[model samples]
Target: MEGEHSHKPADIKARLAAGPKASYLRDWVYGGIDGTVTTFAVVAGAIGAEFSTQVLLVLGAANLFADGFSMAAANYTATRAEREDYRRLLEQERRHIRFFPDGERQEIRQIFQNKGFQGEELETLVSLITERKDVWIDTMLAEEYGRSNTQSDPVRSAGATFAAFGLCGALPLAPFVLSIPEAPSAATGLTALVFFAIGSVRSRFSTRSWLRCGLETFAIGLTAAGVAFLAGDLLTRLF
Candidate 1:
């Protein structure tokens, strides 16, 4: 299979030793998309209002840092909360196993029984699983609470978000900072490119083709920027 690895014993042993790879793809994609969309929205609005280049640069830069940090901090807090929640549940499971071993065993048996294990097989399976305290607790956590075996690193997750946000967000302000000719159009073009690029990167984790993902993200970002531009134009005309 395309994504499958060799099932040879040695290969399996090495793979297991390496452990599960933690993915920060979601954090990066979230940050990248938001950064491009929001920064470009600011640019579009400023352009619609006929703001000076200096004003556009100021606003765009402010959004890049302020919004990026806010997003990173939020991500950190959320990831940490999830870890804490997992730990709390883990301890609770430990306590349950300690004080109510028989009940916990019944839970394990019922859980597997629902999966169709019966007779000696179920008894043997439960015995094998319960022999190890860590495995026993983990199985209960996974079966009862649907918790993942791997937890994310909050600091790493937040770092990924902040880095992606800053990198993608900077694209919109590039033209202005460089004093490019027709900087507004340049900013729009560049920001659109960033949106498409982010989507292309995102497609690696999905079933969709890169081009389709890129176009989809491009359209969404363009729509958001268009709305911002129109809003600014409407407000300008009214006031």
Candidate 2:
């Protein structure tokens, strides 16, 4: 009776471990917020200075491409360097595990002991973990050195950032791009929408609700724009 209902294939019955979640939320949010903020800052600045729509388009487009690409490239390099550092540290941990295993065993015992294991249970767990070299290595990397097994994808991260940067960052220029009348006012409204949208996307990764995050992002963006706009007005008036 226990075996009679078993119909699943062997591979189907066993679930494999999936790849770790990519650590790109920071890059995504940063790129998204920064891209849009900088582009909008330029637009607001141009508007304050009473520049023609042609001047707004020229400045906004230049800041959009130049700044967005630069941020994406920087994220890629920084993320790649982080992965390389992790790899190097992992190799060092492996060597330590190999050459000084007794020391590592003591360290493992201490780690679990700190977790409240004692007597037979502590010894048993240490034995079970060290039985597999990979598990042992992972334990040392996590327990002793405070690291995780996830490998970051720099190219993927960079692409996400760049895509966000390009899509949302260029929003402020949309009115001018389309040659809409009263372009500055329309662009401000559009900028608010863009801020809320990016913030909603950001909520998926963080614990914050979409509404709170959206409002907060919107506020920060508008504040930045106001400052930029004010600075432009001051400079224009002074000159």
Candidate 3:
């Protein structure tokens, strides 16, 4: 029984460590979608307003840089804060164990009991977990607080978020470069086609059926573009 329990933590640790790469990818992709959607809407609105190409370019560039950096900074700060909070909680748990061993032990038993453990089995499990200081801290973190000791580098996450967002945001503005003197309609059509394709590709990451996800994303992009267009038209009328 002890051996069986001993093996479980290792399995849990392994499971926890695995798949973070894919998780990171999904985060990056989703963040990119957010950035892209907003920028696309802004650019579309500007185009609909019949703003000078120069003004549109400036707005798009500003949106890309500002939104990307802002998102990255926000992510960095949030992740760092969460890590600090986790550390504080862990230290508090350690102090409780040190100063009130009996109380803490009883709390651990209660935690296990809440999970439906009872009798000698619960006692054995609590004893096993609380015997080691690290394990004890981990158990409290998991059971009492629902926290994990997983370390995520805020700087890395922020950088990835920025890069993903910037790359995606740049896609919608690509048409502006070609809008030169000869063909604005062609440029707009091309931009719409490209954005739709991107929406479809992004949909593959979600759990929804590909067709459904693709359509939803496509509609969202179109709706954003249409709103911007209408807003631009209204502004043109008003001012």
Candidate 4:
């Protein structure tokens, strides 16, 4: 019975350690949407300027590659920096334990007291937590470290984000790349349809209604297209 009881906390900790896949998926979806929206607007604007198809394609391709790499690199560097900061904080905490044991114990006592454990129970809990080096450190981490489970692999997160964004960005422009000489309008219509579908699909990440997601995405895409088209037309007039 004692053994079984002791294992319960370990089991709970194991369950807590499990990664939240939905959160990662949501991040990827958002990244993709951002990339797609920005790129689509730029491409549409360029096309509206009555530039040759070659020029539009070149611009779109450049945007896709540059933006994807930039997002990925930024994610990688940021995650790595955060991880390093966390380690450094942990090391400082360990040093505090070595050099200021009394102060650390007092802090732990206060922490437990604040949690409603008082008198002997609080003393026992504090003693148990401080008895082991690992347990002691973990308590300090929870109470002081303020660390939470987040994406730890900078490279993996970067790769996933870049791939998701690049794929989404390429979808609308694909029609332009594949268009035959006689069917430009058809290609544009097809691209719009794809944009709507991507938006609807992305809504799943937000756990929102498909209709709302679709409409929101449509609004964004339409707004970008409208603004770019007007700008392009204005530029043509000026030049």
Specify the highest-lDDT model's number.
1
| TM-scores, all models, native as reference | 0.90, 0.86, 0.76, 0.71
Tens digits of lDDT, candidate 1, 60-179: 889989999999999999999999999999999999999999999999999999999999999999999999999999999999999877999999999999999999988988988999
Candidate 2 residue lDDT tens string, 79-158: 89988888998899789888999998999999999999999999999999998989998998888768787867989888
Cα-based RMSD of the predictions, in order? 2.1, 5.1, 6.0, 6.2
The digit string of per-residue lDDT tens for model 4 on 89-163 reads 778878999999889999999998998999999999988888887778768877876764343677777887898
Determine the backbone clash count of candidate 3: 0
lDDT ranking from best candidate downward: 1, 2, 3, 4
> Which parts of model 1 have CA positions greater than 4 angstroms off?
1-8, 230-239
lDDT of 3 by residue, 73-110 (tens): 99889889988999999999989999999999999999
Candidate 4 TM-score, C-alpha based: 0.71
Q: Candidate 4 — which pairs collide?
A: none
Worst 10 residues of 2 by lDDT: 11-20
Give the higher-TM-score candidate: 1 or 4: 1
